[model samples]
Target: MVVDIFIPCFIDQFYPETGFSMVKVLEKAGVTVRYNKNQTCCGQIAFNSGFWDHAKAMGEKFIRDFKDCSHVVAPSASCVGMVRNYYDEMFYNSALHNEYRTLKKNIYEITDFLVNILNVKDTGATFNHVVTWHSSCASLREYGLKDEPGILLRHVRGLKLVEMEDKETCCGFGGMFSVKNEPVSTAMAAHKVEMALKTGAEYIVSTDSSCLMHMQGYISKHNIPLKTIHIVDILASGWEL
Candidate 1:
């Protein structure tokens, strides 16, 4: 059960703990994890910004980096989604088309890999706080992840998993969208934070760190008591923060 861990650029830069926490959860479940330090971004941001030439080069490098791994797991749904769903198209008509397509079959977002591939429902996690799960737009629509997080959360000892309204709504962290439309992004994130606050949950959890980052921005600015947590952080809490 050796797995290759793909740390997205954002996670590598801002939330490295979540990546390590994911590895802890996997190892706790009796899985061996390997990280390729040479790995870099999945080129999702460049692709989304319509820089196909640059993104293709980045994607090619990404394929070369993880093409040999038996299984590729990433905590960021957006990066995993880009690699799994979009890379094929990017590689179409290119020499690396088959290589990229083959890699897609092995790439899995953390939750999807845990629930679907590993058949792991829980990581023996325990937390006393009440938490709400945020279904990031990419996780919900792109990855089609609906119940995986819920299944894992339910098994945590002494943790209450509450559902917030409009869980499917985006947290306004569509990568460049947040930067291009700051006001709208802030407004959407504010609404999302408000919903989490109404639940009286101490933490709002999501698989996507970008969404949490956006929502946390608003939460921090308004001095909200809520804390944004990645799902892996919650699951790996059984070991230690």
Candidate 2:
């Protein structure tokens, strides 16, 4: 199947490798993927921060960018959740409302696309390390993604998926919340990191880069050996590591 890929802002800038890994994984799976260079942020940052006008403009741009694609896939669940869950509300009563509805239905998170549409559990990946999954709040609660990633990870050749404590708890990376409530964000992150570390996991796998970015910062600050990995990276390992 042909699919259009959307790379969120942070992933584009901070985690470009994740995007590459996703492309590699999809291509290896016999899926034809297209990347729209004009695509930018999904307006999630502004929409989440209460900047409706900015969000609407960005959402319209996103809709226009991939209007012809039969399906639009994203590596970040948070970004996909924004388009699927908030685009309609952001464009309500606007000229682009109907367009937003059509675009929203085509958007799918990577794991969701792989597991649900492709109907495949394994991507022939191999990572010989003990790892645990971190369900980002947006991916878990907002998008209702519970088993897609787990199902895929379970089939990886040498990867062991351990259940981390409070798997559903927020990782303290609520985009604007991190800035507005630094103290609370840090406290929550500390607790989440503590729980993750206690699992004796070598790497914490998640679909959203924002959560990994936040947790990586704390992990660096605390000098913890635990590392954050994107699901795409894990899936693209190809038994090499």
Candidate 3:
């Protein structure tokens, strides 16, 4: 199963390891991964900020970048969701509509591709840590990804997965939302961090690195002992502990 891996801008810039970890996990599952160096931002930031013209240009570029690929997968659900859900609105009533429709269907968030499409639950990896899962807003609401990550997490050799309060709540990293509404975003993230800490979780894991990165800021500033790790990294950890 050959698939093009779309590395979201955040992961590509700030957390490149997670992107590579995603590739590692996919290969472990017998997937041949292909990466297009020309791939750039999914334009989600622009779209969310009401910059439709900029977003439309980005949407078109994204489609063109991966048009020849049969399957497309991304680690960030937010990016995947943007391409799948918002591209239509970005390119509505345009000649690109037909191509956009076809592109969206071939694209999948990594966990969705692994669990639903591949029917894969375990990745033969291990992590001996007490952790709680944070379901990013886009993964839960946009992509309707709830249990797929948990199903895969449970298969880790020695991971003790704890359920945090309001696991499905947003981590408040709506890209520009955090910057434009700093107070509210920080408050939401602080509350989320508090909840995860209360669970005695050493790590807060999620399929979306964006959520992890947002919550990580609060965690780091307060000198909290907790860490944020992407699910792909966990699955590819492979007894590294």
| Residue 29 displacement in candidate 3 (angstroms) | 0.9
Query: Judged by lDDT against the true structure, how good is candidate 1?
Result: 0.89
The digit string of per-residue lDDT tens for model 1 on 102-205 reads 88898999888899999999788888899998998898888778789999999998899888997788888899999999999999998898888889899999
Which segments of candidate 1 are over 4 A away from where they belong?
Answer: none
Model 2's alpha-carbon lDDT is: 0.89
With candidate 1 superimposed using the best TM-score fit, by how many Å does residue 18's alpha carbon deviate from the native?
Answer: 0.7
Can you write out model 3's per-residue Cα lDDT over 63-107, one digit (the tens) per residue? 899988889999988899998888878777888877888898899
The count of residue-pair clashes in candidate 1 stands at 0
Measured with C-alpha atoms, the lDDT of residue 200 in candidate 1 is 88
Candidate 2 ranges beyond 4 A from true positions: 239-241
| Superposition-based RMSD of candidate 2 using all C-alpha atoms, in angstroms | 1.2
Could you tell me which 10 consecutive residues in candidate 2 have the lowest summed lDDT? 88-97
The local lDDT score (0 to 100) that residue 118 gets in candidate 3 is 86
Tens digits of per-residue lDDT, candidate 2, 1-241, equal 8989998998899999999998988888789999989888889989889999998888889888988888888998888888888886867777877777788788899999889988878888888889998999989888889789999998998888888889888988899999999999999889888888888899999999999999999999989999999999999996554
Q: Give the range of the ten consecutive residues with the poorest summed lDDT in model 1.
A: 232-241
Model 1, residue 228: distance off in Å is 0.3
Ranking by lDDT: 3, 1, 2
Listed in order, each prediction's TM-score against the native is 0.97, 0.97, 0.97
